[model samples]
Target: MTPTSALLSTRPWPLLLLLTLLLPGLVQAQQPTAVIAARATLSSWSDPLESLGTLRADESVTLSATVTDIVRELNFRDGDTVEAGRLLVRLADDEAQADLRAAQALRDERRNAVNRLAQLQSRNLAPRADVEDARAQLRQVEAEIQALEARLADYRIQAPFDGRVGFRNVSLGTLVTPGTELVTLDKLDVMKLDFTLPEVVLGQLAEGLSLTATSPAFPNAVFAGEIASIGSRVDPVSRSVTVRAELDNPELRLRPGMLMNVVVQRAPRNALVIPESALIPQGQRQYVLVLDEDDDYRVARREIGIGARRAGEVEVLEGLAEHDLVVAHGTERVRDGQTTRLLGILDDDTSIPELLRRGRDQAEANG
Candidate 1:
């Protein structure tokens, strides 16, 4: 017999088979264990409703001239905050002033004549017809003066309300006509956001319903508002109902005509939650490897039912019990029925003494 064949024949066949069977187990045990851990938590979860909206001024108007006239003086600078009844513009009133003076003189003359006529009538020195005529003339002259005074008021422009004004379209010598655009005034103490929602959701849209909005201009900031009004009818074309919301704008950061993303919350409920990293998908099924209740740190695959997700957390609708530890951070390296090492629960960083106590307990249990 050859030397190699003789040596192989001397070794027992049962012993050789046993060693081959044990080799795979030894190699698996020597492999480094992946470290990943998370404890399931109970948390509040709500499915958020979202929609697109537009921001608007609470109150807005365009200032204009009441009559045709040349602008003689401007009382406000562009983009100035003004108070109610503050003069904004003055129009040239030279011709109106001349007519007013003439009317006043005629009124004064008529008044003198009426006084004389009254005295004459009391003395019975003049006929009743003459006194009546003189009094009628006085009335006509006083009416004329009043008409002139009313006309003069048209030359002055004043703010109808307290607000901020935009740029003026006319200059000092520019002549403006009635209905001519002068400037814009907006009351910005509060802002109105108008948007539409599908008619199917009419039950959810109501006065006092709270909502939140965000804008690209202020990406990190969120504005809170409430539904102020609902439209009487839904638009036939879009099948949506218009809704308006009011938001307090103390800082005046939000401006009209800005596009915003809006979110509304409905009824919320408490649910068990876990980090999204703990999930693993295979074929058409989703699962998580939870640490088995043993000192060996073995993990088992668990199928889970999921619900609405927000931020980095996912709601566990089923299959996950509270306080159950699962592989979260290093799920990619974990396998079903595989050995692993505990790195503490996710986000469980705390005092060093607690960590040491946990380590000692685990060691004692394993030993």
Candidate 2:
């Protein structure tokens, strides 16, 4: 049993009360229940497919090394924002600089020799073979010098792209080798949300469909996104397909690795709605205790084609009308053909927008 079930199960008296109440004319006629009721409503039913999703950075990287050396300087602090090619870290480049100077000297000497040989070749005084050999030697030395220059530049590490840098795992003055971890960089301007959908929903899924998601950090704020990708293959065991949505996280608050609830809404259509608490499930049969025109409370069987639930209201389909009134609470004490009066509704949705505004006003006043 669930924790709620266990707590309520503490008393077997309610179970007995329910059994007696369901019996025909078992409860005394003079007894009146303090129950709740809500007038039925018509809503633009939204076929919103909701699921748990995880947020991830659109791009991430582990900045490391291409050359090994003693650490000299770290250009950024932990959690600093960096741009593409911005200096991040640097290593001791004394050896690299020496090698560069040596390469330049050799290259200069070779160039002079090549120039002298070319003049002689023009005069037809130097051997043609000598000129060819000088050209090859110059080219060889020049190529080596270029390679050394590149290695020297690698000593100063720079950011590869615009991103926020993570905590520095290593400190300055620490000797590091090639592939040593420096820091992590993440582009958080956009995020990707990953979720799975039943195979039946795959038919309606498409690229650029809208998504609304909520997280605990910002309770009232809803983040929007569009379908970025959908897996072509379905999982055999779960019969679901993977889906990814791209979110524009402009505030940089929607961080990667956040767990959240995602709601995918289709176009709005018509549906009948009643309070969720009113719908009671007896075995496989779903029933709602409702009040008819004659002010009689009865356990009415309903074929419920369910839809999205929002703001404490549940959308119902089949066997209901807008003018219908459903018993919101006190259902456990009601029976089929039991006479009951209209009690105040707990989830009455009449004038919802006004009610919501009033709630907000009351909260502000209380605060």
Candidate 3:
């Protein structure tokens, strides 16, 4: 070809545009599809035992006045963290104080009168019955005074424990009566979530069986705790046993009545695992999507036996090699030998304790 002919043929700009318009399918066939990319990972899946639970504090108490009185002063405000013996509310004690003073004065007077009567009786001036009457009067006054003091003390509301106080219900001068809901007090520094788990695996759950928890208040965050209490007997009807775990809520962030999901960690000395979302069930078989580098990803139907389901992940038993990535998502849509785009890799080999600690830090930072 001549120089001009070569230059004319070299112009791919116009030809490319024509091919784009005329051969759309041919052009598209040469391109790659990034259909909801998901990372391939090997996860050790443990047989999962699903359990339902309700969130609750280990110890929660509501404050109420036992006597009818006007609130003189609220020593502590709402959300106040109080120590044991901390005074919370004080009722109008003017009448009680007056009564106590009168009782004391009358007791003193009766004692003096009794002494005088005893002296008279010894000198044969007063009768034995008179002395006995005086002594009885003094004893009556003393008893009365003690009773008044006891009643006076009840006028003050105190913290029964080292705990956090709820919002104030009755402010200063608010008339409150017996059974009046004053406020809620809870020991949140350490909280417990009472739950029930299937009693079939009683051996799996015991003291020191690890656990992880997360609440809606802080999503993507896990709180750490241990199996604190286990019921001695399992209910035959429900086939479930009560399990309670104590969580260190030092910041008082996790409150009672806050719903949460708990994961009990069974120790894995040398475990295989993968992301939970990666596993898809087809009939009786479960599998994951895995990529072998390049665009050479495949929907691998893995026969994985699992151990424990925890924190959006699971432990695997069979049908997967270490580091052999299984697809995380879209396994149902993918077929064996089909191509896939590698999305991201999830940590399936990290120590459970490390994972728990990292989750706790994330929760604290967010909180």
lDDT of 2 by residue, 1-367 (tens): 8999988877898888888877756554555554556778776666688999999888999988877788898899888888999989888999888888988898889889989988998999898899889889889888988988888778888888888999998888888998988899999899999999999888898898888999999999999998999997999999999999999988899888998799987665677787777778767756776676564554454555555677767877666777777777667876677666544444534543454456567658966
lDDT (Cα, tens digit) per residue for candidate 1, span 137-237: 98988898898888898888888888888887889899899998888889887999988888988886668878889999998999998889999999999
Q: Kindly report which residue stretches of model 1 are placed more than 4 angstroms away from their true locations once superposed.
A: 1-34, 39-44, 94-153, 266-271, 280-304, 319-325, 332-340, 347-367
Q: What is the per-residue lDDT of model 3 for residues 1-367, given as tens digits with 9 covering 90 to 100?
A: 8999999888997898988787977865654333233333444333334454566766789989889999997888778889989888899999999999988988889999999999999999999999998999888888998899889988988899988888987778888888998888888878877788887788887787767788878897778888888998899999989998888886778878887787776543556767678777778777666665555665545566666667876767776777676665456666766776443344535443454456567658966
**Candidate 3 worst ten-residue window by lDDT:** 31-40
Which scores better on TM-score, 2 or 3?
2
Error of 3 at 297 (Å): 26
| TM-score of every model versus the real structure | 0.65, 0.64, 0.60
lDDT of 2 at 168: 93
Model 2: number of clashes? 0
For lDDT, the strongest prediction is: 1
Candidate 3 TM-score, C-alpha based: 0.60
Off by over 4 Å in 3: 1-52, 118-132, 232-237, 267-367
Backbone clashes in model 2, listed as residue pairs: none
Best by TM-score: 1
